[model samples]
Each structure stands twice: as C-alpha cells, then as structure tokens.
Target chain A: MWERNPVIFLLLATAVIMVGTIVTMVLPFAYVNTERDAIASVVPYSALELAGRDVYIKEGCNNCHTQTVRPLVAEVIRYGDYSKSGEFVHDRPHLWGSRRTGPDLARIGGNYPDQWHYDHMREPAAMAPGTNMPPYDFLDNRDVDPELTRRKMEVLGFPYSDEEIQALAGKTDMDAMVAYLQKLGSDIPWREQQRVTLVGELVNPFAGDPAAIVEGRELYERNCAACHGSGLSGGFAADLTALNYPEEIFFRIIHDGIQPLRMPGFATLGNERLWKIVSYMDSEQVAP
Target chain B: MERPAYNYDIVKHFVHWSILWGAVSVLVGVVISFQLVMPQLNFGEYLSYGRLRPVHTNAGIFGFAVGGFFALFYYMVQRLCRVPIWSNGLARFQLWLFNIVIVLSAVTLLLGFSQSKEYHEMEWPIDILITVLWVAFTINILMTIFKRREAQMYISLWFMMAALIGVAVLFVVNGLSVPVTLFKSYSAFAGTNDANVQWWYGHNAVAMVLTVPPLAVFYYFLPKSTGVPIYSHRLGIVAFWSLIFMYLWTGAHHLLWTPIPDWVQTLAMAFSIMLIAPSWGSVINGYLSMNGQWHQMRDNYLVKFFILAITFYGLQTLQGPLQAVRSFSGFIHYTEWVPGHVHMGTMGWITLLICGAFYYLAPRLYGRELYSIPLANLHFWLVLMGQLIYSVSMWIAGVVQASMWHSLNDDGSLTYTFMESVLAMYPYWWIRGLGGVVYLLGIGVFVYNIAMTARGAQASPGAAAQA
Candidate 1:
C-alpha cells in the first residue's frame, strides 16, 4: 500500500504537514510573550487617530513603511534607541514591512510637525522636493464623512467613543492620515546624551591640534592622493574633496567605511587623524 | 489504411514563437540593467523603472519560461500518452493568443497600466485575458491526459498537473478586485486580508510557475538528454506531492517579523524549512539518474546543462530554507541577499534548463544538425559565469549591508544613516550591471543560433508530423 499508490503519498504528506504545524507553528505560540517596558510608553490611540490608522492600512502604507527597528548597532546609533519587541505587544497587525519604499516610521512623531506630514502626504515632491514618493492628494477634502471614518474603524475593531467621533465630525481624510503619521516613533527623550558620551570615549588627545593637519596632509599624500587627487578635488570615480559636501561628511568617511561604494569607512582612522583630514579639506575653503 | 505520422508541426510553431518572446524578455531585461547604471537609459514618462520592472519580470516568466513549457509539454505528452493532442485546433489558437497576450503585456506595462502587485501587476483586463487563455490551455492538456493510451502517467505529468491547477487557484484568488476605472482597480481584500492574499499569490507563483513547470520540463528533458530513464519514478512522486503540500503554507515566510500572527509566521518558517526535503529529493534523483552516465557530462552539451541546472536547484533549495529561519531571515530578508537568491533560481536553474531543453529540441524539430554546437557551448559558459558573478556579488553586499544596518553604539542609537547604507550599494550595483551584460551577450548568441537554424534546415523523421 505504501510503495506505489499516489493516495498514500498524499496522506503521508498531509500527516507530515500536521506534524510540522505542531512542532514549528503551534508550539512556539505557547511561550512567546508580547509584553515589555516600552509597552508602558505606547498609549492607545484617540478616536480620530484610530480612523487615520485604518486609512493607512487601506492604502497599503505598511507595504512601504516599517515600524520596528531591529536591535542592531547601526540601527540603534542612527535611529535613536533600538525598538523593543514589547513595543508591538498591543498591535493587532504589526507594521514591520518587507520592503523600504520609504523610510521607517517607528519614531516619526514630533520628528516633523503635523503640517509637514500634511504637505508631504498631499505631494511629497512639493514638501521634500527630491522624494520619489507618489502623492496622496485624494485624501484632501474628500467626500468621506467623519462618521463613516469612525464607523469603519469601529468595524475594524478599534475601540472608539461615539461622542468623540461626533465632536470631530467633518474632518478631512488627510487629518486622520496625518494623525497616524504623527504617532510614529514618539517615545524616546528628545536629547541623546549617551551617544555623545560614547563618541567622546573614542576621541584622540590631538583631535583639535594644529600639528595633526600637517601629519594628516602627509598621510593623505602618501595613502589617499592617488584616488582623491593632489588638489583634493576628487579627480576620479568618487571625488570626496568635492566642494559641495561639508567637512562633517569627511569626518564620517574617516569614521565609518563605505563598502559597496568602494570607499571603505576608516574604522582604524584615529580621531586625531580624522580631525586632521577634516582640517586639510576645510583649509581649501576660503571661509566665504 | 492511412496511419497519420506524429505531429511535430505544432511543436515547431510553439518552439519558434516561444523563443521570440524569450528574446523580447531578455533584451528588455538587459536594457533595464543598463538603465540602472546609467539613468539616461530611463526613457522617462512611462518607461521609468517602476513601470519597466513589471515588463522584464512578466515577460521572462510568462513569455519565456511558461511559453517554452507549452511547446515542450505538447511535444512530450503525445509521445508519452501514445495519442495526439485532445484538440490541435485549440492549441493553434492558444499559440496565437499566447503571443498576443505577451505583446499586450509588454505594451501595457510600459504604458504604466499596472495593479502594482509584484508578478501579478498586469491590469484587471489583462488579468482576465490570462485567466481565459490559461483555462483553455489547461482543458486541452487535462482532457488529453484523461484519454491517454498509457495507463501509468509519467512523473512529468504530475508536475504539469500541479502547475495547471496551482496557477489557476493562485491567480484567481489574488486577482479578486473591483475595477474603479479601465486601467485601475482596488483589491477586494483590504488591510491584513489583502496582505495575506498577495503573499499567498506571490509565494505560490514561485511554486506553480517557477517550481512545478520547470519540474515538468526537467523530468521529461533530463532522461531524453542522457538517453536514460530517471533513477526512480516513485521518488519523483514522493517529491512532487510533498512539494505541493508544503509550498502553499510558505508565502507567509516573506511576511515574517510583520504584523501577521506570530503563529502564522512560525508556521510558514517551519514549512519553508521542511520544503528543503522534497526539493532535494528531485535533486538527488537527478544525480542518481546520472550515476552510471557521469561520463556524459564531459562529452554531451545537453548533459552539462542538465546536471549543472539540477546542481543549482539543490543549492538554491538549501539556501532558501536556511534563509526562512527566523534568525537568518531577520538578517537578510530585506537585504541584497534576497535578490541573489532569486536570480540563482531564475538565471542558474530555470534559464539554464530551458536553454538546454531548446537546444535538445531544435535539431529534432528542424531536421538539421545544430547551426553551431561550439556556439551553444560558449553560450552555456557565459550564462554560468554571469549568473555566478551576479549572485555572489549580491550575497557579499547583502551581508555587509545587513550587518551595518544592525550595528549600534553603546548608547543604543544607530551607527549608520540610511544614506550611508545606500551609498554602500553602488559598487556592487556596478558589478551586478557588468554581470547582466555578460548574461545578455550569451542570450544574444542563443537567439542568433536559433534564427540561423530556422532559416535553412532539412526536416527530420518527425518533421512531417509538425505540419
């Protein structure tokens, strides 16, 4: 019965699948916790904000934006604190999207004002000028009633007060969309004191010294002149010494390496050496 | 008594048209690759990357891969079944419509009439056309199987059956939408339901289109290439059934670390891991079939393509399941590694096998020796080198990017900006473009050889059957 029959193979495959469900799928759910410290900070949305979240989902906004930042070192440094798993405990459908058509929105709240989000939504190019994002002008002054928006959110299982919906009646769809955008990445303290301390720990004694310039110039001539040019004009493929960039950008090149760009971040470059390189690049400018 | 000779004429016609569409697909792909490096290749307006991407993907998948399968299936089925196609008139109509649909897809996608769904991007009207065309093709094939002279259906038939049924289900379900205008439609499934359906369609498209159809072609062509039967038909049956059972559960793997239920994500990851077993079953079967015929790899061009293609299939299956694990997927899910994985399957396994199948069929269909065996051999090497370079460079880039993006300072802030990570991809992108150029050159050689062969060739034993 087991040797040649097709039915037996189907049965065997089904059994294996059921077993797989038990081992891999159902088993993991028993012990997984959704609670964490950040959950204390993540508050429930207002009635209007909930309506906007529904709009976000309807438009497939989650397809382009992510709400979670993995606890990787680079992510922590650039995007503020790492996102905790517990931060998403209250979320019914998580928004950790697979693609990055736009930037992550985990902590977008207060990063830009509500007006910025409103203008950005209406036409990203008008707001940012260089963005590739499509316009969501359909949200502006749409015929959708505030009551209808509230009902939709209610139907989607968002707990909202009827009085709250009645009070905010006739609000535009853009208002809700902006409200949702305003809630992104809102938890961290405004200032990052710890980051400054870490950067300070890695500093060199001669970081602001005049003599470091001569030493860095000599090093640049020996190691960097072939690619960057003698005049530091960035003569070849990627001209780092190009006039358009700020000196801080050069400081970054000395600190972190660019890999796929073929310009490696100088992780080994001393803080003093980096400052020197910055000095050489800054000297080319007439201070005008 | 009039004994009708076997019909190779329809087979010949399918071969020619399929190759034409294949040429369009690869040429567009090459042009788009250059556009990435030199943005001047962006013809502006409708010819932008957002629109042209669907053109390259849809053409290669439906036009080249599936179209080639149609020709191969039609030719192989009749011989195996010991009967002619259930309806030859229907097949001829299908061939013409097939070409028309491909042309329409190219035109409309370039013109920017898309649903913005990956692989299912064609507008609602074109989606309906595809459904009808597929149904007609499926009916013809299935009915032929129903009346087969041979009692035991071969392993190839199993894969063909999966593809026909699987595609119909995936396409119709994912394609359910309300058309707001002639060129636009909103999905019937909103929010989470829409996401579930899209990935369901997306990952299963891989199963039906990429996995099963190729399995059908591979099962039929591998034995034919080596002049030997497979290692075990029973093993093939086990692998096929297991693949069907496991693949549908796996679409959610792409939705990992998302808002989807943790249980659902875990289910997909587990199923994805289990998928390795069935995939490797066919790979092992291919290797075992070549047990005594290992020497053929040295002398036979067809065997070289077949063996290497299977080897790549094995590697891809192993790599894919590993990537599905939560830890590994976390690292590489949105990274450059993902593209490397996809291209290895497409360029290395699928395209390599398709090219081999055509080479094996060309002489048999035209009744002539190859226009040039040496050129075919050269084409093989170029594609192999190109696919390897493309995949490896992307893999390295993905690892670096993933690690950098994950890096954090002691104070728990991000170390690299998004711009910095993006800047890192330029060199790898250049290398990838160079690799694409090499692959494109090989495809050019393939097209030239086919055109020359068709221009002047004596008909073979089965040549009378085609007309």
Candidate 2:
C-alpha cells in the first residue's frame, strides 16, 4: 500500500468535497430566472422559416452573426434591447453565438430589404467597403440548383415539401437568410418609442451667456462646482479644461449617440443648448 | 563515490520517441500557421483550420512535452530517491500506452471527432483512456515515493506529488459529462458553473501539468547537471505550497466581465494577481541557484537552455497575472493576446526546458556522446527567436485589433467595422507563419541531433557523458 497518511487525508478531503459539491447547489448561486415573459405578436417558426434556419446553420453563418445582446450602453444603443431569456424560448439550440465576426443579428428582422442581404452575402465587399468576410457566392443560382436546396433541407431535419417552397416570397438566395433575419429584433416593443425632450430641462445653465465671465462663474458655481470642484478640478470622467476635443467634436457627442459605451452623443439636444453646457464648462478653472 | 544505479534504458527509449513527436507537433504548428495566412494551403474538410488545430495542440502538449517529462521524471526519480522505480513493467506499459493515446488523439481529432474544449478536446472515450493511463502512472510514481530509501523528500518530489494529484482531481472534475452520443456530450455542470469549472480546469491544467512539472525538472536538472545542490530547498517548498493554494482559485479570472458572479470572478482575479509571488519565487530560485556558476552557461549547452527557460517562465507568469485583471482582460481575453500568452508557456517555457532535459538525458541514458552541442545551441537560438517573434507580433496585433474594435467616433458609433479589425491581423498572421517555420526548422535540427547521438559513440568506462 502507498503510505496511508496522505491516503487518509485524501479520503477525508474527498468526502468533504463530494458532500460540498452535492450540497453546494450545482446551479450558480446568483441565477435569476427570466424565461417566462410574454410576447403578444411573436409566433413559432413556420415551415419556410424553419428551412431558412437550416440554411443559416449549413452556411456556418453562426460563425459571423451573434444572437445574444450584451447588457451594455453601446449594445443597447446599437442593437436595441438587451437580450432576455424569454427571447430564446422558441430556439432549440439557442443561437446566441459568441463571436461577432460580422454583427449582431438578434434584431436584423426587417432592418433591410431582401436583395441587400442577398447581394451582400454573395460578395460582401460589394456592399461594405472594407469587408473581410468570405463571399458566399456558392449559394448563387449557378452553384446551387433550387432542387439541391430542397435536398440539403432534408439532411437538416426540416420536413419542407416542394409546395411550401413554391409559396415563399422574394425568390432568390437572399430570400432564405432574410426570412431568418427579418425575425431578429421584431420581439422588442421599444423599437417604436418616440419621445424628444429639451436640453435645458436636463442640463442647467445658471450663467446667462458662456462668453460673459461673470455669468459663466455663476453657472459654473451652481451646476458644475460640487463634482468638478469649485475650480473645475478633476472629477470622475475628466477635468473639463483637460478636454482638447474640438467644439464640433463636443457638439456632435453631446447631441448624438455613442453605441456600446455609456457616452451618449448629444444629438438629441439643439446647438444652442450644447453651447450653454460648453460655456459653463469653459469657465471653471481648477487650481492644479 | 558510491554511484546509484539509474534505469537508463527506459529514459533512452522515451527521449528518442519524444523527439519524434516533438517534430510532428512543430511541423503541424507550422503548417497551420501557413494555412491561416494563405487559405489556399487549406485542403477541404480534413485539413481545414478546424481539424488541424487540435492536432497541433495535442501533439505539442501530450506527444512532445509530456513525453519528455515522462522520460526525465523516470530518470530523475530513480536517482533522487536512491532506488529503482517501484514498477518498471508499469512504466514501460505506460510509455507504450502513452504513444497509443497520442496517436489516437491525433487521428480522431483529424477525423473531426472532438469534444470542442480547448486543450481537452479528445472525446469521451479518449478522455477515459487518458484518465485511466494517468491513474496507472500516478499509482506507480506514488508507490515508488513510498518505497524511497532517502530519508527526506526533496522539493522536486513535492512538485511531482502535487502534479499527480492536482491533475487527477482537475481532469476528473472538469471531464464530468453526460454523453449524448459517441463523440458528443454536455457538461454535467451547466451555464456559468460550467464555464467556471472548465476554466478552473483549463488554466490550472497549465499550472499542474505544464507549469509545476517542468519547474520540478528545472530545479532538479539545474543543480544536478552542475553537480551543485539547490541554493535553498526550503524556498522551493514555500513556492510549491503557495502555488498550489493560489492556482485553484484563479480559474474564474478567465470569465471576467461575464455573467459569472461578481465575487467569484473578483476572487479569481485577486488570486491570479497574487500568483505572481509564487511564480517568481521559482524563477528567482532558479537564478539564485546559478550564483557564481554562470560560467557553465557558456560551456554547458544544457544549462543555457535551462537558464533561458526559467527566465521565460518568469516573464510568462508575470504577464499571465497582469492579463488576468479585469481591466486588461477586457482588452485582450478573446484576442490574439490570448494565443500570445499561451504560446509563451508552450513554446518558450515548456519547450526550452524539455530540450535541455532531453539533451542532458540523451548521452547518459544512451551511453553515447551528443552528436553536436553546437547544433543543439543552434536549435535553441532558432526556437527562442522564432517563439519570441511569433508571440510579440500576435500580441501587438491583438491589442491593435481590440483597441480598434472598442474605438468610437465622436458621433457615438464604432469607428471601425469588425471586418477592418480582422483585415489588420493578416500581416501579423503571415509573420507568425514565418516564425513557425523557423521554429519547425529548429525541431528538425533537434531530431537529427538526437538520432545521430543515439547511434554515434560510447563513453569511457565510469565517465560522465559529455554534452
């Protein structure tokens, strides 16, 4: 026998670990189940949609398109809603693919016309200037007969009949993928939310005009002094004077939107509203 | 001097065969790198990047590195303990079975049967075979340790024991599965729990099997080749225990910024940062052991490789923990920086140490002089330069790609599309291909040197073999 000393230790430790493993909850301690939300308009994939899904898998399209939406400011601004567990209920293998070689396709549904997606896939650079994605010209009519697509569907376990194929819309290579794409982000209700608010309501400008030194100090003291410091010392993001960005850069960012980052472009605010915020920012000078 | 009888036959056999597989690994690695640069190099399905990747990894880790370690361990253990192996028959069986396992792993992976886990890509059946093989080998080594005639256990023995037990626990736990079919299986643990365990096993697989075992060889061989005892055995023990304690908790560092619990990820990140202490402990120990004996680095080809290997290990460990932090992980986790980190361990640390150990063992084990030390030194420089070029270029490529992807225009949209970032990596990929060719050339030289050495000349009676 190999000396019993460590064997005893192993046995005791194994028992403790085995018991801990069994009793320690195999599921993550922080899980919050979110699969039960309801969707009024969503429906399960029709037979034709199922065929399109098969095409998606066979083409290795999952390598490029991601389905999952990360919970970040940029993701929400760029891709619409953050992914919820309920969005994946109908998916059998859950195509929340990891790599973003192309773009997120969770909400690509109806985002573009069928021909655009078709021509894009066939020769990606034809549509986008700097694309490295290999052209899927193999899916063109010359390479793939309509009959072969039917045969390929059989291997993928879709029980589609010729009659169903005859009834499909937009008869081309793009039609199949677009059918899958059109369903991407159609589930979220916030897609049509239309609201616009004034900039002055959100940002305070106590100082009358930014060019007027006395007025600028008054605005700076009231609105920006506490966080930026009385002299506009470094706050969380950066000291205001430290920013060497051009006036146009600040104007565009303050009014427009930056996706995936917390920095929202200020495009929603008017030109005069952004100038007021800039004026107050220029007036504060930190001692350092 | 009362010379202890060493089992040279098995050592000779393992060293010879390992050099063969080492060539295969480097050759495959070179071809794969070429395929990335020129897609025309890819022959359809069987030879694509998808299939060749596992072959490169398995050949490097299991076929070459592990085989070299096996040969060295067998040789070192017998002499260190002042006794014969507890079971030569078991070890011989292990050597044969080990080759079978590597061959099977290579063939099956090429045939497109994979579990799809990064390093542990072998399917369920092969995983079981590996587990059984490891268990048998572990039993034999532990039994030999049990029967040792030496009074006090050396620090190398402590590392050997940790590797045996650590790998057993890690391999078994991470490999737990519910098989759906012959080659397919779902992890028994699901979701973030699964990711946690997988990385836990994944990163520590580097530690226990790749990291500690090679350090054991370095610590033993460095002093032994120079005929000097270690500078401080007690320091080596401290490094060993600290490494064991910290390594397990650092696995979830890979899952930073993901859905895994904030606390778990933070804990792993913290432990990974703390890991630098133990890692450098061994590095410092290796260098300090070389005090006033730096002259050997010039005359002794084996010491050159050994010293350089430890230096690389020190750099690799420092880089690894820094990358594990959340801020840095955000930039590099899924990028070319990731592969750069891995190859440093594989090409720089593990390969260099194995080369030194093999060169030292070949002459004594085979009772012949090394055919050429100049050729061995030549091999060392080529591989060293090649690996450095490969890793550095990839690291720069990954950082540039990541920063581009994360960059935003003032208008709040991404400055570069995903395609533009990928386009930037092609030149780096081509450079990496060139670097791999250089490394493969080095392996070719090494294999030739070993083959000629085995058949070359006899040593004088009772004389130590020359490098």
lDDT of 2 by residue, A108-141 (tens): 6655445556766666665554454555554454
Model 1's TM-score against the true structure: 0.72
Per-residue lDDT over B352-397 for candidate 2, one digit per residue giving the tens place of the 0 to 100 score? 8998888887777666678898899899999998998899998898
Worst 10 residues of 1 chain A by lDDT: A191-200
Model 1 is docked with a DockQ of 0.11
lDDT of 1 by residue, A27-97 (tens): 43333333323346656667677656656644556545666665544444444455655454434344555
For candidate 2, what is the DockQ? Answer: 0.06
Candidate 2: global Cα-lDDT? 0.68
My TM-score estimates for the predictions, one after another, are: 0.72, 0.73
- The DockQ of each candidate is 0.11, 0.06
Q: Which candidate should be chosen as best, given lDDT against the real structure?
A: 1
By summed lDDT, which 10 consecutive residues of candidate 2 chain A come out lowest?
A16-25
Write down the RMSD of all candidates, one decimal each: 9.0, 12.0
**Candidate 1's chain A scores what TM-score?**
0.61
